[model samples]
Target chain A: MIENKTNKPQRDGFWEKLSKLNRRYIYMSVGICVIVPLLIRMRLPIFITPPTKSLYNVVDKIPPEDPENMLIISFDYDPSVMPELQPMGVALLKHCFAKKIRVACMSLTVMGIGLAEMATEKAKEEFPDVKYGEDYLIFAWVPGWSIVILKMGENIKETFMADYAGKSLDEFPIVDKIHNYEQVPALVCLTGSSTYLSWITYANTRYNETICTGITGVIAPEIYPWLQSGQISGMLGGIKGAAEYEILLKKNKLSKVEGTASVAMDPQSITHLLIMLFIVLANISYFVIRRKK
Target chain B: MSTNIWVWIAALLTLSVYSFLYKDNPIYRFAEYLFIGTSVGYSIGFLYWNAFIPRIVRPVQAGDYIVLIPTFIGLLFFARFTRKWTWLVRYPIAISLGIGAGISIPLTIQAGIFRQLQATMVGDFTISNIIMVVGVICTLFYFFFSLEQKGVVGGVAKTGIWYIMIAFGAIFGYTVMARIALFVSRVQFLLHDWLGIIK
Candidate 1:
């Protein structure tokens, strides 16, 4: 050799190999971890976190007053995040319907309209007596994001003169008593993006509207500061939040059917454990390789 | 198994996307392009009906010619296509930016700064609150470049690094959960909705 390194003999091929493992193998392992528990019908215990409970309690406590008891649910996500968000949307709708609380659904993103319709339809299947014009309505998505929120604060009917079907909102009794954030008890936003901040900024800060969020896991940690500040009344974070809400609904007899979030929890838990194990293994391999060098 | 034709198409597309895990292939590319194309098409259609017609066409048809003002301003955005007329695009851009700033500035400061500061400072003296206050202060110290980071300042900055790292770790964990949840949903569709193998 031209010049042998000081510790050339100390190199371990095993650590080096482990450190250099193919990403495809890890992906396959994750796939297995996700698919296996789902196939085997494994059930994992889902602990209800405080934030989820707070969300449930907030919705539960809304007085079932006529049209004033109405809740505005802003669907701010698309099909891409429907996996984590749609279940919570359905669960919330079911809860609202079960309690006889009216809902006015709208979308900030155009793509959220389909998701909103899907969720409403799914919840409608369970609550057959729920009427559209009387018990709920779907407002067509307008272009502006923050401007829409600010406009709704002034007059909801003026902002959205018609529903999604092009029917005048004045024809619907649901919008008769509900005009702005003043009449509604709370505004629940289901989102996978930072649009919840718009609700906090315009809806809560300006109009004093109570804002609650059901958000994707990626934005969960981001909401804690606002949650602590009482800017957001409650939150359901990630799929686990959905599962917890489902459990709460089941316990309260608001939902009889098993929700998708509840069913997915088994796979979710197992996948999380598997990922944590991989993280540990990768760190161990790196440390071992470094020491050997 | 789902007898619906649409469900079958969706399931096949989902599989096409998953096929990328093995290696990049034409099937994956096809599915990717299809998704992008469909989304863009849907958006354009939605905007035309929901925004263009309702906001501009309907009002103008009803004799409210005032709506044409904003419509004309919006059309100016197309001026960027011409070399000589490109400067006209800035008028609408400036107006929108001015209005956006007017709306966002006060609300942002209230929601993002004042409320957060109040919460951090005026919270009850619990152990968690104490830790949070300290963390906030130290993190602010880390960002204060005016002071030379040496001795006590350096030590506090290092502590701030620990908090920052811990926050990053938590976010990473949640991101992983989110991605896995998406995968689990697809698998659920394949098993329960498509194949009817699970309920």
Candidate 2:
């Protein structure tokens, strides 16, 4: 027992142990927190936020009969961010397909091509009636995203002369009337990077096109100023945002398939709580250890 | 619990990657290398088939001499390999930088500066709007180094610190959520997609 400045006997090594806790213990705790909730499913209520609702409303308003019902979805993320952004992409595709709204899907990054394909495949499994080249078109990735965006603003056909499969864009009736951003009602960018700013800069600022975004949560706060400035029409932030969109889809009877985002929400909530608890515990341990020293 | 070959392969790769959390080992290193190598190979293949062929090779083969000009300029990027011809790389570099700057400056100003200022100034006088406007001014004041930060400027800058701290806290929270979301996704894949333990 050691005496401190206040003449109080020093406590035992609990605080010291906690302060120097093995990282493997924390990892195991996180793993259990994530897996348990996922195994024993719980239906946690998902409240829809305004930004997500705004995005849904924008997509909902596009008339199916309107010749300009085309929506350009840019998948600007890779597998590293696929966990957060893929659900958002799949939900958006499902919404568009259910509403009979045409889609022109493209990836700014080559790595995003696989993710885009995965999302589209997942959505297509639900909408078996939806035919490719007529209902939707997937454009292949090109180098220089900023220039590609600007070129698409001028003429989409010239920018993407062919689809992802090397078929000419002219062969697709979905893009027959969509010459550029003018014919598309809105361009929804799903990104894990700052490429959305390029859309805001080149597409919205240069051509005055409507731009919305579904971004990873890490970058969502940075986009608030753009949303406030009316540069971005609406936004979906992270997996939570994807879950909200899924709720909207089910409520509108647009999708009957269970959404992966909604399914993962319970685990996400539990893991968040566990992390918060760990942070508080660490702080307390740090303070206690400092006092003891 | 799963018989699918692809699922089995994915599960093994995922476990290999997760093994790093316990201790770094050869399995984790192999998985890491595999990921990097595969990503690079995929990108090369995608660019060659989609971009190089469509934009350059096919066009050059079809009697389109105009495409050769840009191709030749792009080829100049390889000049850096030779010391004497390295000066030629500067032409393409300068052309790219010039074009990029020319295209981005006005658009960046319009999207980032003017519109933001307009929104901050002209919005309705709601509580949130007022807070935004005041926060913006205080933050700008915090960065203003012309005068001594002593009087009201100091007070405003102090408030700016609070705003910046709050913003950082929110971003930190979102970052945690993003990371947790990734973990949850992997868990879901293992439980549902691979093991069929969850529906």
Against the true structure, whose TM-score is highest?
Answer: 1
State fnat for each of the candidate structures. Answer: 0.86, 0.84
Tens-digit lDDT track of model 2 for A150-217: 99988898888888888888888787777888888899999999999999999999999999999998
TM-scores for every predicted model: 0.97, 0.97
Q: Which whole-number lDDT from 0 to 100 does residue A54 have in model 1? A: 84
**Cα displacement (Å) at residue B49, model 1:** 0.9
Error of 2 at A283 (Å): 2.0
Positional deviation of A137 in candidate 1, in angstroms? 0.8
Which residue pairs clash within candidate 2?
Answer: none
- The runs of at least 3 residues in candidate 1 whose Cα sits more than 4 Å from the true structure, single-residue gaps closed, are A1-12
Of the true contacts between chains A and B, what fraction does model 2 have?
Answer: 0.84
lDDT of 1 at A161: 91
Residue-level lDDT of model 1, residues B1-199, one tens digit each, is 9999999999999999999998999999999999999999999999999999999999989999998999999999999999999999999999999999999999999999999999998967899999999999999899999999999999999899999999999999999989999999999999999999998
Deviation from truth (RMSD, Å), model 2 = 1.8
In terms of lDDT, which candidate is strongest? 1
* Residue A44 accuracy (lDDT) in model 1: 74
Provide interface RMSD per model, one decimal.
Answer: 0.8, 0.9
